[model samples]
Target: MTDGPTHYPPPGAPLPEEPEPPRAMTGGTRPPGPPAGGPPPPPTPWAPYAPQGGGGPAPQPGYLLGAAHKPGAFPLRPLTLGMIYDGAFRLIRFNPKATVGAAVLVTAVAMAIPIVITAVLTFTVGLAIDASGDVESEISTADAAGLVAAYGSLLLSIVLAQIGVIFVTGMVAHVARAAAVGRRMSLGEAWAATHGKRWRLLGLTLLINTVFLVLFVVYVVLWVLVVVVSPGPWPIVAWGLITVPAMICLSAWLWTRLYYLPVPPLMLEDVGVFGALGRSWTLTSRQFWRTFGIGLLTVIIGSIAGSMLSSPASFIGQIAAFALPEYAALLLVLTQAFALVVQNAFYAPFLAAVSSVQYLDLRMRKEAFDVELLREAGIVS
Candidate 1:
């Protein structure tokens, strides 16, 4: 060994130590003291708090936030009943041409078809009754058959009206969904979106209506039994007092639970009728009272609005009827038609918008659908 350079430590000189690694300054560039202001440090966007009871991690700072801060047709959060109501009106206000025009077109067709069928059936039945001589005389077999045919035609017209309602509802729902996310959809666009789905929507409506019809028939049968087959008055009175009310309550409850549940999935998810129903049932689970209360409130509000709009037409009709008694029947028909058109135009969109908002609200609470909606709107990456 060559003892290179013969280097040695000087006497009393401390051995050089490795330089200490730099410390991470808690507050960069500031003295080791509290921040200058009394206000707390801003929260770290990445920092997460533990949930209470150690259930789960708390939501991240921006995770639950909605798409944009700007107010749209719907707020970027879970909706209140009031918000839903307001949103419904806002949708109508935002897109009257789509909402009102679609409703009017569909409702006019629905009303016209039924009215024409009913009129023709009535005229035919009246002629037959007249041919049978005295109108108030006992019913003959032909007259009975004619009456049955007329009533059956009327029933069919009613069914067609229901189908038309389903079509209009689907159309309006599409428009409402577009409006909710700050989009404007034309009536044609809405109809096109719902074009292939109307039959399925109609099927769903028929299914629901059938359920209601069955309940009504069962109620009527029970009532008949209570009146005709019961031994005494107390039973009839008891049945009327208890069973009827119970059935009515049950029907109302079921209606509230189901009425708006399927619209969202049907329109947005593009699901089949039965699939939509199942999805709706799943979404509505454990939230029956909330959904029911919102639905009932929406119905009452829409009904009041429709009544108010239609009342003016009715009042004017009454005035005309009194002023021109000879043309009273004609005025009555025209005015009633006008009222129906007005009611349908105004209330159809309103009900559809309410249902759309309710559906969106339900999905947000259950599925965090706001995130999805925001993402789709490109508000969130």
Candidate 2:
């Protein structure tokens, strides 16, 4: 966002010239310098970089190779909206082990153990309660143990599922980055990328959602207070007239314009949590609407695609439940879990790929990162 170069020189750039020796202010003694400009150090390799007024790097003609230069998921240029979506799918195809595969693996592991344990405990407990004749009798220790295990396992599954999604997103983000320049990482390699950063990423993901949720709860509570304390219909009118509109406006402004934009920076740029938040904020400046629109579109697309992929199982489950009420509960739970796994597997990586491409696309457009990436890919001579 500054008027200076937004990037450091590329990897092979020469070091900057050393500063002149300090001159004492006590006397007018000048420091000796380069022997009357005797051929300055080979003009540093960064010579090719041109800095635009707003931190953009110089153009590299070598990168104009068009499709020939695109070795990865999408072309190595500023992307159109459709290209972003296309890039997401291409990344999945190119690196399934790191994207959808990882997602499915994590979701299955996260859901499987807990669901089985919870189901068994709940079923056995239900049978015990049924045979206990008096419905009002105090719960036995065995019943309490079963209930505790059932509830705890369900709660544990949710936590694991959330953590797994976050970790998978982190892996997918890097996969998108590597794919931009024709790099491929194995499943273990992608998992290794998040070795020390998962907790930080999780904290960041929670911070954004938690802040928005607190704000929403506050708005609803205020309306409830107004309705309860006020002795007239004015509070009801105000709730409709003010509270809902205010909540929607505030949430939309914060969530739509900036949701999850920071995750890529945290993952790819290796910035701290707050640093990533600041980076995303600056990157989206003057480009908010484009990013927001792309994000909204991806959500719609992913939702439709996920539903299409997962809905059949759900419909079948409902039908089976109705047709065989005796086994309905177990059948429903198993079918719903399968449907969720199918949906989560598809959605997580798809959304992450879009977000990663959007981040890279923004960088390329604003700071000539495409030139850097082109050079990294050896496309730019």
lDDT scores for all predictions? 0.69, 0.76
Q: Write the per-residue lDDT of candidate 2 for residues 95-128, one digit (tens) a residue.
A: 9999988988887887686568646754564412
TM-score of 1: 0.69
Residue clash pairs of candidate 1: none
Instruction: For candidate 1, write residues 281-311 as lDDT tens digits.
Output: 8888898888888877878888998999999
**What is the alpha-carbon lDDT of model 2 when measured against the actual structure?**
0.76
**Among these predicted structures, which one has the highest TM-score?**
2
How displaced is residue 51 in candidate 1, in Å? 24
Clashes of each: 0, 0
My TM-score estimates for the predictions, one after another, are 0.69, 0.75
lDDT of 1: 0.69
User: Candidate 1: how many backbone clashes?
Assistant: 0
